[model samples]
Target chain A: MTRKHLSTWGAVIFIAAIPIVIAANSPLLQWRDPVYIAGGFAGIIAMALLLFQPLLAAGRLPGLSLAVARRVHRWLGAALILSVFAHIGGLWITSPPDVVDALLFRSPTPFAIWGVIAMWALIATAILALARKRFRQNLRYWRAAHSALAIVIVSTTAAHAVMIEGAMGTMSKAALSGALCVALLVALNDLRVWKRTRPGRGITTD
Target chain B: MTKLHMNRRTLIASSGAVLATGVAGGLAPARAQSLAPTQSMRGGSNNYRPGAPIVERIGGGGFWMTGTVRRAGDGAPLSGQRIQIWAHTTEGHERDWHSHGATLTDANGVFRLEMPQIVPAFGQPHGHLAYDSEEFETVFLRPVMSSARDTTLEAHFVLQPA
Candidate 1:
């Protein structure tokens, strides 16, 4: 990798790892049960994965070729989905009623609303991806639908991550959330998902 | 390409500054409330029970949970409203069954319960109180004590009817 590529990768890794390291060292986690801790860490990991996603899709990350990047993106997507489930499931086990309230959109924290919205958007995007063969028929429509959900996921997840003063070290969490938004914005701008995406012309490795 | 690189560098540097500031400020200690109705908090339902036994006091008594329940707009005292209370305590974690209890407001809408001293948990010394009964719009309050050393933590609820 060139200096540019090396720096880009380093920055990505730096932003992604800082929160996990901080959260792992957080004293608050010592007071929490294993289930809550698992849930909390899964949430942190999910946010880090979000940072990789758009950069991968935009083929902006170092080393991985576009096709390889896209492939890794899919795998990471699966990992992201599973992490989200673990995050919610672990929390649900720890406190069913609170999780229920959050799922039902009655959670009192400002973060809960944003989290629920992002969670649903992520789920919806996953569902669409499953049936993306149909969407591949019309690249423009697929990009529109995918990009729209991506925006929702990016924005609301950022809101959700930042609003809660949780086990995650605050600064790293804020920085990660900020990077996630920037990654999505950069990806969207580079891909021009809102504009034409004629088949075979959507994603390319120049 | 240069501009994008500069942007990324700036982002990384700015984030570094934030991390430095946060560490200096004690790693973003626990704080804040809200986004709930007036005087009612959103996470109030945390550690709540629908019918925690109406106890003389929460177990391991030393701390007091005191508050007045009243109508939201008019401030009329709401008698007989069940206020569920729980907290991580010297006796047990708030998630423990024993650390939880309930009490009802008097004719004057005042309710008080004693429980074990609350120690700092999740980076703050706090207690949870909820008005989960159907009598009022449900409200949950997680009020942080200014100091864990304080013996009494009060949460006043001005609630709307369910």
Candidate 2:
């Protein structure tokens, strides 16, 4: 691989690993139970996957074809779903009532509300992805709607993740959250999901 | 048995009342109007023990783990509420059971426990505190000190109705 290629991969790895490493080094982890730690790490991994998701979708990642990227993105999306489920499941094991209240929108904690919103949006995004062949009938509308939902997922998830004062180091968490937003914006811009889905423009060929 | 607790009661009884915001004697806050229910931060409860013992002091005293306990919204002082205190200290890390203990709020809604001086861990000077009473929603506070050299760390909790 070329120097540029190596550096590109390096930056990606750095963004993905730094937050998890800092959180692992947190002094607070000593008192945590095993399940909580597992759940927490899963959430962190999901965030890291989010950083990868948009890049893959926009074909910005260095080494993959659009076909390969699309496959990897789908698998990563599935992994994202599983990671989120594990995240919630772990917390549920730790504190059932809090999770239930969050799911029901009755939790008083601000983070829970944001988390629930992000989660449902993610499920919706997954549904859209699964029905992509059918969505081809109105590809502009589908892409635009998918992009909008992706924005909601990314923004609310970032809010949910950043608001928590758990194991993640604050500065690193903020940096990761910032990176997630930037990645989504770049992907959305490159993909041009909003390019022709308007009042004046007709549906055009890709 | 309790210097922090007894001193507070004595000061309140003798003075009848004191200044609102000043750290006069053991009063935590007369400014409860500003207190809001604290959100339990994610991952803040890492090393929490469900029933840390109510101790007069941890590690034979010197450092202070102090704060106010009040009801959310109204901010009424929560008398007798159990507030568990723990931290990485001069003696050991917060993960050590020896570094953990609990204390109760006085009639004024203030609670303080003596412990060994807190030491910075992972480059931050922080102490972990929790209010896990059945009567009130749980709150986990991880208050970081401005400097590691400081001797006292405070973490107030404004709990919502359960």
Which candidate ranks first by TM-score, i.e. highest? 1
Task: Evaluate candidate 1 and give its CAPRI docking class based on DockQ.
Answer: incorrect
lDDT of 2 by residue, B1-162 (tens): 111223565567535544533445666645444334677655457567788899888987788888888776566888999999887666765667898899999999999899987765432467788888899888887777877668888877778888
Q: How does model 1 fare in lDDT?
A: 0.79
Q: Which stretches of candidate 1 lie over 4 Å from their true place?
A: A197-202, B1-64, B69-84, B88-93, B102-126, B130-152, B157-162
Query: Which pairs, if any, clash in model 1?
Result: A108-B42, B44-B140, B44-B141, B136-B162, B137-B161, B137-B162
Indicate the residue-level lDDT of A121 in model 1: 91
CA lDDT of every candidate: 0.79, 0.78
lDDT of 1 by residue, A88-107 (tens): 99888776766788898886
> Which candidate wins on DockQ?
1
Considering summed lDDT, which 10 consecutive residues are worst modelled in model 1 chain A? A197-206
Residue A112 in candidate 1, Cα distance off native in Å: 0.9
